[model samples]
Target: MSISGLNTLKKGQHYTAKELDSFISTTDAVLLSNNENQLFTDPEREYKVTHELDGFFEHSEEDAEKHFREKKAYVVEKA
Candidate 1:
């Protein structure tokens, strides 16, 4: 399937189950999870971490660093 088709699925537009299955089968990169004996696919991309932000507010020092890194990586990947 084309990237445009994949984009459509990510947006939650109406599509037949068969179409979704076909697209999933053909994609090189896909997300999947095992649930209750069934394999489910995640259409959204995964997140990653890569930076440090404020070290004194919102969350504990550890958590704040983690979140900042994650958001930075997410932004970079989207770019």
Candidate 2:
């Protein structure tokens, strides 16, 4: 998706599965790897993050940054 403004989802906040899915879908990302990873079509990229219980999708540390920056994913940092 081509969001014109800054993101409304805070930097570190948890969101429900439905909410997360909606954001991903609206952004034109295809849920992959059993909803763990997402494939972005426009850029022809795939993002996979390690899954956390309270987070939208599993994000690995290696890929988290890219995923967050590209998809504007809501990432709730662990305490």
Candidate 3:
């Protein structure tokens, strides 16, 4: 299935950054993973960390950064 953005992104699921970029460009949703998010995550917040719909999210937008800019996964952080 095609995802909308990073927030709506489910945990432990595999997704390509190229695919997500496409979804973000089409909406008002600026990636929450934009490093501007402060809270990151909140139990009371209904908003997902990696919001995929409008491409706009408040916190935890950087959640997808690792996947988007990974040059050497094992070499850098040993995933």
State the lDDT of candidate 1 residue by residue for 1-79, as single tens digits: 2333452233323333344445556644332222322322333432221222222223556555433222211011110
- The TM-scores of all predictions, comma-separated, are 0.27, 0.29, 0.28
Ten-residue segment with the worst summed lDDT in candidate 1? 70-79
User: What lDDT score is found at residue 36 in candidate 3?
Assistant: 37
How would you encode candidate 2's per-residue C-alpha lDDT over 1-79 as one tens digit per residue?
3333323443334444444445555553333234333322223232233332222444578755533324333333222
Q: Which residue pairs clash within candidate 1?
A: 50-69, 51-69
lDDT accuracy of residue 57 in candidate 3:
21
Question: What local lDDT does model 2 show for residue 25?
Answer: 55
Off by over 4 Å in 3: 3-14, 34-79
Badly placed stretches (over 4 Å) of model 1 are: 1-8, 31-79
RMSD of each: 12.0, 11.9, 15.4
Once fitted onto the true fold, the runs of candidate 2 whose alpha carbons sit more than 4 angstroms away are 1-8, 28-79
Residue-pair clash count for candidate 2 = 8
Question: In order, what lDDT does every prediction score?
Answer: 0.31, 0.37, 0.34
